[model samples]
Each structure stands twice: as C-alpha cells, then as structure tokens.
Target: MAARLPLDLDPPVRQLRALLLGVDDRELIAPTPCPGWSVATLLDHLMSLAEAFTEAARRGADAGGDRPPRPPSAAHLSPHWRSRLPVRLEELATAWHAPVAWRGLARAGGITMPAPEMGVVAANELVMHGWDLARATGQDFAVDPRVLAALVPFLSAAPAEGTPGFLGPRVPIDPEEDEWPRALGLAGRDPAWRPPRSHDVPTVRRGSREQPPAARRA
Candidate 1:
C-alpha cells in the first residue's frame, strides 16, 4: 500500500503569515467575515488555536484538558500581537512535523479526536480564517489544492446546514462549481458575497509548486 501523505501545515501557514505581514494596526478594528469578530479578534483566535493545536501535537489526548475556552476578543490581543501571532503559528506548523504528532488521539478546542483528524481541522482553521482576514482587509488571498484536498473529505461529510458556532449555514452554489467555491460553501461562506470594498483579487499561488520570484520556500 502507498504511504499516506503527511498533512502539510506549512503551505497554509505560509499563506496566513504573508497575509499577517501586510495587516496594518489601523485595520485591526475592521470586521471579518466571522460575525462580530474584528481582524484583531480573529488574529487573537488564530494565535490561541495555533497554541491549542500545537499542544495537541505535543501532548496528544491530554492537550486541551477540560477548561472552557474563553471567547476570543481584541482585548486579549497583546500590544506585540503582530509579531507574536505569526511565531505561534510557525510553531504550530513545526510541531505537526514530528511523526508522533500524527499518531494516537489528540484534543483541541475542548474536543478530542484522532490526531490526524485534528491536524486537518487545524489546516481548515488556517485557510478559512486566512480568507476571513484577506477579505476583511481587502487583500488578495490564494490557496493550494493540496490544502483543500486534506479538508474535502471532512467537509463533504459535514452536515448540510453546517455546525453551529463552528460553521454557519451552507451557502448555495452551482452544481459544477470548482473545489475552491465548494470548500467555502461547505464551510458556510458565500462564494459570491463580497465586502463593500472587495474586488477581483489578483491571483497569488499558495502552493509549494512554482512560486512568485519573492516567495519563500515555506
């Protein structure tokens, strides 16, 4: 049998990091696609989720414990958040690189599941929220097919109305839609919906394949 490919968090991580670098402090208060979550709030949530998933990779089932997660807010954001969040996210990608991180069971967001499954959830959070930030701040966003490939199976099995609190209701789309729109729709985001300032985003490849001249080997 062929070896199952290790789920790569680095690609999504790099995309998010690039978006993070461009965010201005003035834009922190801008509203994201997630209801009531500002860019600052979402960035804080990303930092916390990164920490949680990295711990899941390190400690397996013992990671999240039983503490109720505090609701994410801009107030929880540190003055140094611009630097801190990316570092934490980088560590998240690094932790998952260990083979043992993908074995046994893991816990995150106060729920436990197989480590492999949780890893997919982590990637989903990255890409989905990456879209949230880019849209909120009126920036272009790109995603690699491999990242969506890891998420397709799980999203395909998700409920039609979507999971409350985790994801909202499904957005309708045409039957022949490509994987990108399909993925967003399954995650309860409207593919056609745009922010007041949103425009056609110039494409930037978020893959590990041929990259822009300045793209780092992430």
Candidate 2:
C-alpha cells in the first residue's frame, strides 16, 4: 500500500502568521459567517486550539500519556483563550520541529484520530477560520493552493448533510481540483453569484462611461 500522508506543520504555521497581519481592533468584534461567532469569538476559539495542539505535541511525546486539561465553562471561552494564543503558538512550533519519537495514535468520537493529529487539526482550523476572518474584515485573501489541496479531502470526508454546527452546506467538491468554487460552494456561497433582487446586485460598468452611482437616497 502507498504510505499514508505525514502531517505538515510549516504551511499551516506560516498561514496563521500571515492571517495576523493588520487585523484591526474593531474588526475582531465584528460578526462572521460562522453563526453566532464574531471575529473576536473566532480568534478566541483559535487561541484555544493553539494551546490544545501545543499541549498535545508536548504530552504525546512523553511516556504515560498526559493529556492537557480544558476549561470547564463557556464564560472563560473568549477572554482566557485569546489572551494566551500567541505564547502557546510559539511554544508548540518550537517543540514540533525538534527531534522526537512519534508514538501517539488512537481513535475517538467516531473519528479515527491519532494523538499526534495536532498538525492536521491545526491546519484545518487555520485554513477555514483564516478565510472567515478574511471575509469578515473585507480584506484581500487567498488560500494557498498547497493548503487547500491538502485540506479539501480531509473536509470532504465528513457528512454532506448540514447540521447545527458551522460546517455549512455540503456543496459537491471534486477532491482533486484546485479551484475555489468547490470550497465556496461548500460554504453556502456560489462562485458566480448574482443577488436575486435587482436592488441587491452590483451594477457593471463598461468602457470609459462610469455607471451611475447607486442610489444614495432611501
């Protein structure tokens, strides 16, 4: 059999770092497409993820399996988590590259997961929510082809039906393609979207003649 794919941390780490550039204080509190999560809420969740992956990397390498504990309440969800995100990312990245034995593997919660599945897990979060942050802030963004190529398959394995969670609708994804249509389709937006209402869609301008300004008066 062909060897299974090894987890890659460099691309994800680089992507996360890039996403942090020029993020505004106001934008963090702005709403995101992820249901009830604001950009700050999303950041809080990502911060917790950095801690979890870092702890997993450290403890998984040790004998006797010391799993890092999680906070018990949702109240501390935003404040406590986002506060320590950067520190934890620095710590985990340092350990992840060092020489270490890879002894972690297991299955849980219907997903056949490994203890050192930290890299892929982190990659998923950074890739998806990184896009969420981009759209929320109206910033120019593009998923690196390498990152999407790796992640789309992983995401495709989950159910096509929608649930209460933020998985959004399952659009038909060609697991082998490089285009953004597959990803956007899965996320509840069409690639070639034109709003249904005449007032909602943007008008196109051609040649040197500027389109009349959209109505300013209500």
Q: Provide the TM-score for each candidate, comma-separated.
A: 0.86, 0.63
Q: For residues 1-218, could you state the per-residue lDDT of candidate 1 as single tens digits?
A: 54454698999899899998888788898888898888999988988898999999999999988886778989998888878888999999989988888999999878999998999998999999999988877667778888888787888888988886677787877879998988898898877655554365433433325454455445
Tens-place lDDT per residue, model 2, 6-78, is 5556665655565566456756666665656777777766666666556555655332244433422334445
How well does candidate 2 match the true structure in TM-score terms? Answer: 0.63
Query: In model 2, what lDDT does residue 35 have?
Result: 58
Local error of candidate 1 at 12, Å?
0.5
Clashes of each: 0, 0
